[model samples]
Target: MGSGTIVEVSDLFQNQPARLSFQRRPVTEMAKIVDIVMQHALSHPNVAFSLTNSGRIVFDVPSVSEYDDRLFDVLGTQASGLIPLSVPSEDENAPGDERWTGWISSPDITRGKGDEVHLFINQRPIASQPFQGAIRRGYKTRLMQGRHPIAILSLKIPPHEVDVNVHPTKRDVRLKHSWRVLERLERAIAHTLHSVATAPDSNASSLGIESIKETKTETETETYKKPSWAITATQQLTLSGDSARSLEPEKKRPISSSPAIQKTIFGGKPIAPALSSDERDIHRYSGIESERPDSEKPLSEIINELPEMEPLAQLADSYILVQSGEELLIVDQHALHERIRYERLKEDQNQWKPQSRISSISIELNPKEMSQLQAVSSTIKSFGFDFDIDSQSMIIHSAPAILTTSSIEDFMRDLLQDLSEDNQRALSMEKIKDEMAFMRACRGAVKANDKLSIAEMRRLLEDMRCIPNPWACVHGRPTAMRLTIHSLDHHFGRHG
Candidate 1:
C-alpha cells in the first residue's frame, strides 16, 4: 500500500443479469483473478507485484532482475532442487530471435500433472501441447508413470515467427517453425535432465519391481528360523513408532467424525473386486506353484494366513524373503504396504480421523488446482486437513492426524494432478475416491530403499493378512510371489 500503485474493481457484472446468474462462487472468482495475476507475475518477475484477498496478503513479490530469486520466493522449498539451463539460439547478436531459458525441476521433485510446467513466449505465458510434450520427452523414463515434472521456461521469438493471437485470452500461441522449436526444446530438456542432476537418495530402485523368477533371495537372517526369523500371524499389527517388535494384537484406529474432507471422497460403494495374482517369474521359471494350493481362501490371502509364514528376512531393503511351509515367498515391501494402506483407507472412511494440529505450511495453487480443490474439498478435509485459502495461496493450519505432514502433502498434490486434464473424470465418483485412496496409500507407504528392522518387517507382513487384496499393489505390481520347495529341489537336482 506504500508506493505501489493500486487498482480495484467493484460491482463487476452488475448489469449483466444472465452472466451473474451463472457466475461462479466468490472463491472461484478469486482463483481466476489469482491465476491471471500469477501468470503476469511469472512473465515479468522484475516488476514488483502484490495480491490480496479480503485484505490478506496472498503473495508479494519484489521487483528482481534474477528469475531464480523470484522463483525461490514464490515456489518456496520446491525451487531449491531446480536445475538451471540456458540454451542458445543461432543468432546471439540478433535481439528478436527466439532463445530458450528457465529452470527445470530435478527428477526427485515432480508433479502428477504438467500444470506446474509453465511456458512463456516473448515474455507472455502461453499454452502449447508441443512445448509441454517436448519437456516431458526430455525427462524420458526418469519420472514415474503418470507423473510430470515442474518447469519454468521462456522463449523470445520474433513477432513474425510467433503468433500470439490464436486465442482471445492470448494464452495459446502458434509457432511458425513448430517442428524445429520442439526438437530444440526436447533436446534441451533431455540434456538438462541427464547432465549434472540430483541423484536420488537411495540405491533401491525397485519401486517398479519386475517379477524376477529365478532371482536369489538371501538376507542375514537366512541361517536362522524359529526365534530370530520366522514370525507367526498373531505377532503382527501393533502400529508403533518407538517399538516395532511388540507381540501384541492389532489395535484398530478409531474412525473420527465423517472425514474432515467435507466431500467427494467416499460414495458408500462396495469395495472393488480384488485382482488375481499375475504369475510372473515364480510361475514361469520354476514351473511350480502355478496350481493354487488346496485352500478355500484366495491365493493372496493364503500366503499370509499360513500360521508359520511371517517375514524371515529383508533383501536390499526392497523385498521380504520368507520360508513359508513348503513354499518360499518373496515380497515387495513398498507394494505390500501400498495395498495394505489402500485397503485400510477404505475399511471405513471413518478411520481418516478429524483434522488436527495446525501446521505452518502454505502453498500456491493455480486456477486449475483451485477448481480441482473446489470439486473435492470434502474428501480432502476428512483426511485431517484444515486450511484457509486466499486468491493465490492456501495457508495450511492443520493436517491429518493419521499421516505425517509430508505424506499428505504428496497425496494432495498427486490428487490434484489426477483430477486435472479430464481424463480421470470419465470415471465414477466412487472410482475417483478409490483412486484417491490408492494415491494416499502409495504416498504413505515406505519406499524401496528404506531399511526396516526385523520387527518392522514381520509387522508389515503381518499387516498384509488384514487386507482384502494381498497379491499385488494398486498399480498391478505383485506384493508377494510364491516359490515352492519342489521347484528348488528340481533346480538343484535334489529330487532326482
Candidate 2:
C-alpha cells in the first residue's frame, strides 16, 4: 500500500497535485492580487485586459468603446489640477462624417507642469508623443518657463480609417490622416492659452498715459505767455484810421508771419486787430471776435466786454438758469464746480512739482483685488492717484487736485470700477481718458431744476460763451438753442 501511495503522489506532483498549489495559498492573498489588477484596469477602461493565474482564467473586461461615466472617471482624475475649458468642434461647412470635439487646458492654470495630460481619438486613449509635444509648444511663452500644461485632448475621426489595434494594450491608436487633426489641435490650444493669459479683467477705468502727459504739457505752456505785441499794433491801427482801403493791406498780411507789421500797426501791444465793415459782418455771423483784450489784462475785462445777457431769474439752491436773446439756458451747478475743479487740476498737472496734500485715510482690499490694483498701478499714476498697496490694504498718498474735496473712498471705488470695466472691454487708453473727462464734467456741471439769481445766471452765460463750443456741453448735448424772431413770426402765421 505504501509503494502504491508513493507512486500516486509522484504522479500528482508531476501533473496534478492531490493538495493543489492553489489550495495551499491563503484566500486573502489571491483576493489582494485580484483587487490590484482590477483597480488598474478600472483606471484605464479604454485599454482591454485579460488576467489569468497558473493558467486558470480570473477576470476579463472588454475595451470601452465610448466616452461614458467610466471614461469621465479616468479623465477627470487625470485633469483635476487643470482649469476646465471647452470649445465648439463642428465647422458649419464641413462634411458630415468629419466632425471633432476636444478640450484644452488654460495657460494661467497650467503654469508649466505638463505631466497630468491625456489624449483620446475616436473614444480610444492614445499616447502620441509627437501630438503632445505640439501642444506643449503652443504654450511655450504664454506660461511661465519650465511649466507644462495639463490637458485631456480628444478628437473624433472616421472609425474605419483609424486603426485601433495598433498595440497589444490597445491604448495606442493610428490615424490614417493625422495632419489636419494635428493642425487643428495646435490652433485650438494656442488660441485658448492666448485668450486666458493675456485677457484683461473688466472693471478697471480707462485712461491714456500718453494723452495725460500731452495734456499736462499743454496746460503748462498755457500758464505763462509772452506779451501780445500784435494786439497793441492791431488796436492802434483801428484807432488811427477808418479807411477801408488802408485796412485791406493790413488784413492781407498773414496774422502770424507779420508780427513786426502787427506791432507797428497796433501800437506794439497784443490784441485782436481792428475789423473793416465787411469783416465785422462776417465776424458777427461766425462768432469770431474782431478784438480781444491784452493777455496781461484781468479775465473780468473780457467778461465785462462781452454783450450783456439777460439777468439770472432766481437762485434755486445750486443751479443757474439764464436767458440768451430768445433762448433759455439751464446749467448744472455741480458741473460748474467740476469745471473749476478741472481747471485747477490742469494747473497742478502742468506745474513742475504737483502740490502735496495729506489725508489720514486708508482703503482695504482682498488679496485678489490687490493683485488687480497692482496690475493697473501705472495707469493710476497717470491719473494723479499716488498710492501704495500692501497685502492688507491700499494707502492713499495723494489724489488729483480736483478730487481733494471729494470723498476719497467714493472716488477710489468709482475709479477702480471704471478701470476694471474698461479693461475688460479692451477699450483703448484714450477712450478711457475721454470717458473720465466726461465723468468729471458731468459731476461738476450745474444740475437742472435749480433756481439761480440774476447775477449768477449772467455769470454762467458769460463763462459759457467764452468756451470754444458754448452751444454744447462737454458731452456734446446742446446747452442752448435759438429760435429766430422770423421763425416765431412764421409760427404765428404773421409772415403769411
Candidate 3:
C-alpha cells in the first residue's frame, strides 16, 4: 500500500503477469499510508484530494463556492478563466430549485489536446451528452469554433429529484426532468455569453443622438367635424341663455289681478305645435346617425384636438424642438412611437377578449417543432393566435387584431422561431409570455426614421404617457433620455 512494493495478484483470465499490486499488507501499514494521505489533503484545504501510487497525495483546494473561483484555484497558473451562471428553475411551484452553478476545467481547461470540462448538476457531478452539449452551446459565442473555455458550474436543484445511483463513482446523476434541466442550463450559458459579448460599458462613446420635441399643430384648412348632438346642445344652450333673460319680469307683479297677463308675457317660446311626433322622431333619428361617426373616432382625431404648440424647426431629421416657457423639450421620435405602440397593444390586449378567426390555409410543421409550439400555445394565445394541429397541417383559427392584415405565413414563422428560442431555456411561462408580447409589439411598432406629422407626434406623446413603462422600450432599451439645460451649458463651457 506504501512506497514501490510489488506483490503477485491473480488476474481474471488466470494468466501469470508481473504487475505492481498492493498485497495483503499488515493493517498497520495500510492505516499509516491512509493517515498520511488524509493529513496531506487536509493541510491543503483548497485542493481536491486524490491518492496516487507510491502512497503519494495530490490535491487542490477551491477558493470559493462559485464555479469560477473553484476552477481558478484548481487550474492555478494554467487556468484561463471562468464563466459563471445561475439557471432558474422551470417549475413555478419549486421556485427554490434554481441552479446556481457552472462548468469547470477537466485537466485541459483549454483548446488543445486532452481538453475537457466537468459538469455538476444538483451538486452531484455527472457527465452526459446533453448536459455537455448545453455547456458547449452556451459557450459557443465566447470561445473560438473548436476552442472551448475552461468553466466550472455548480448547479443547484432539489436533491431528491436527482438520482445519484446512475454511476459507480457518483460523478454523474440522472435528472428526473432532463430536458427541463438541460434547457435551463443552456439558457444560463447563453445569457453569460450575451453579457460578456454584447455589453456596452461606460468606456464606449455615446451615439450622439439627440432627444426630439414634439410640436403639435392644427391645419387651419381641415374643418373640425362636429356631431349633430353637440351642435344642437350649443344652439339650445345659447337660446336658453337669451330666453331666460328676456322672460324675467321687469318688476315684481301683483299676483291677484295680473296672473293671466304675466303668464302670457312670461311664457318663453310657443312649442312648435305644427311639428307632429313623427317629424320629431325623424329629426332625432337623423341627429343620432350624424353623431355616431364623430363619436366612434380613431386616435388621429384625439391628437388633433390638443392645443397647437408654436412651430419649432426639426434638427437633423430626428429631434422635434419645442419651447415650453424658458426651457426647450426634445423628444426621440422613434422612442415616442415605440412607447405609443406598446401602450396601444397592451391596452387592446387587456380591454378586449381575444377573438379568433378561422384561417382558410393550414400551417404545416414537423413533430418536434409542433411539440415546441404546443409547449408555448398559451403564450401564443396571449399574442392573439389560436392554433390547432390537424393530421396534415396546423390551422391558425384566429390571430391578433393587429396582425389581421399581416401574412399568416410570416406570423407563424416568427411565432415558431420565438417558441424555439424559449424552448431552449427552462423559463417560466410568465417570462415566456412577456418575451412573446414584447417581440410582437416590437415587430408591429413603427420603426425609427419614419416621418411623423405634428399632430401625430402629439398623439404619440399622449399615448406614451398612458403606457406603464414609458422610460424604456419593451426590450429594455431606453425609450427617451433627458439632458438638462445646465448640462448643455456646462458642455459648452458657459457654466465655467
Candidate 4:
C-alpha cells in the first residue's frame, strides 16, 4: 500500500472453530508463517525482507549484495565460525553436478539438534535425502553422535534437471544424474573437512584429541584454562570403593564468542534459522529401548557378574583403563555413560523423567522448530520440561533438574528436532517412547574430555555388567575393548 510490498492476513480461522481446535498453538502458527518468510529470505538474499507481528519488528534484514552477508544478517555471529566451501563440478555432462558454494560450521561448532543443516537448489530452498546424507557422510567420524553441524549449501543447475513438483510441499525434489552429484558432493565435503583440520589431512580412523585433558583426584586441587569448545565438567563422578569423588565445575567458562561477520544479528539465533524435516527414516532403531527379559539380579550381583576390572587410570581424560586378571580393558567413558543412561531409561519408564525444577528463560524460535515443538509437546513434557507459549514468543518456566541454564536451550532444541522426526511416521507408542529415551540418554550422558576418577570409572563398569547390551551404546558404537595377556604375550614372542 506504500513504497514497498506489504502482505497482510487478517482472520485465519474466523468461522472454522472446529478446524481451529485442531490447529497448533497461536505462537506455533505464527512461527510457521514466519518460517516461510525466513526460508524465502535465505533463498533470495538479494531481496530485502522484513517481518512484523502485532506491530513488533520480528526482523528487518536489509538486502545485501553478497549472499554470505545475508547469512550474517540471518544467522548472526555463528556465520563467522563457518568454513567457506566451494565445490567444483565433477563432470560437464552431468546435471546438478555444477559447483556448490556455501558455508559449513566445523565439528566443534555443532548443535545438539540435527535440524540446522539447510540445503538449497538454484537459489530456491529444496531438500534432498541424498544431498543431506552426503553432507553427513562428509562429517562422518568427525562429529560426536547426536551432535549436528550447521550448514547452508546450495546447488546450481538447469531447472529441468530437478523435478521440484514431486513433493506436495516442494521442499523436497527429485534430481537427475543424482549418484554422480552425490559422489562428488560427498567427496568435496569430506575433502573440505580434511583440508580444514589443523593436523595432517587424513581421514583418521581413531580421531585422537589433541586438546589438553586433566583428571583430578579428591585429595588434589588444581587450576586450568578452559577452551571455548569444551563441555562443562558438571557430572558428579563415582567414588572408588567406599569414598566418593566430587566433580566440581569451574562455574565460569571463558567461552570465546565468535566475531560477528556483520553487525546485524539474525533473531539472536547466532546459529541458523528454522529447522526442516528429516532426510531419512529412523536410523538403526533396533528396538533400542525394548524390554529385555532377564532374571532379577540385585545391584551387588549385577556389579559382580563381570570379572573384576580393577580401576587403573583415566587415559587421555577420555578412556578408562582397568586390569581384569591378566587383561587390560580400555573403556570409552562417553560411550559407556551413553549406554548406561540408555539402559537406565529403558529399564523403567519413570527413568525417562528427570526431576523438574522452576527455571525462567525465554527462547526465540524458528517456525519449523515451533511447529515441531508443538507436535511433540506432550513427549517433551514427559521428560520434565514445561513451557508457556504465545504468539509473541515461548518462555520456559521449568526444566529437568539435571540441565543447567547453559545447556537447556541446546537440549530442548535437540529433543524438538529428534521427536519431530519420530512424529512424521506412524510409529508405535513403544517405538516413540524408546526413541525419546534414546535421545534423552544421549543428551544426558558424559562426553569425551570429561575428567573421571578411578572410582567413578569402576562404578560405570559395574553398572554396565547389568545392562543388556553392555558392549555398545544405544547408537551401537563399542563402549569397551579388551587386550588379553595371551594376545600381548604372542606379540612379545613369550611362548608358553
Return the top candidate by lDDT. 1
lDDT of each: 0.60, 0.44, 0.44, 0.59
Model 1, position 365, has a per-residue lDDT of 65
Point to the candidate with the largest TM-score.
1
Model 2 scores what on Cα lDDT? 0.44
User: RMSD, each candidate, Å?
Assistant: 17.3, 28.0, 29.6, 17.3
Better of 2 and 4 by TM-score: 4
Order of candidate numbers by TM-score, starting with the best? 1, 4, 3, 2
lDDT of 1 by residue, 308-412 (tens): 667787876668898777888888877777677677666555645555555466766644466557665665565456777676566677764444454455556
Q: CA shift at 366, candidate 2, in angstroms?
A: 1.8
Error of 1 at 318 (Å): 12
Model 1, which residues run further than 4 Å from truth? Answer: 1-11, 88-96, 201-341, 348-351, 354-379, 386-402, 414-433, 440-473, 476-496
Give the per-residue lDDT digits (tens) of candidate 3, residues 1-496. 2344344545633453343243333332333344343333322334454434346322324334443444443443333434445343333333336454544332112332112344556444455444667666554423322334445455667878788887786756677776666656666665554444322111111110000111114311111112222355446322112234435643473554565543443333432234343222222221101111112213342333323333265444445565434445565555445445545545454523445665354655433334446556676677556667763356777654444323454345444544444213554535534533543443334433345566655555555445566666553445543445665565456765
Deviation (Å) of 459 in candidate 3: 3.0
Q: Taking the tens digit of each residue's C-alpha lDDT, what string does model 4 give over 21-56?
A: 776656655656666677778888878888776786
Decide which is better by TM-score, 2 or 3. 3
User: What's the distance in Å from true for residue 406, model 2?
Assistant: 5.9
Model 4 Cα displacement at 385 (Å)?
7.5
Cα deviation in Å at residue 367, candidate 1? 11
Superior by lDDT: candidate 1 or candidate 4:
1
Tens-digit lDDT string for candidate 2 (1-496):
1221111123545565655665423433444344444445444566665656557555555568653544343333323324433332333243334344445554433321233355667655566465865675555433333334546566767788778897897767777766655645654555454445332111111121011111112211111111122245545322111332233432242354566544443345523334443322221221111111121112232323334467455434544455556644454443443343333323333321333555544666422234346556777777666778754467877765444333445345445544443224544544544444544443333343334455555556555444444544443333443444555465456765
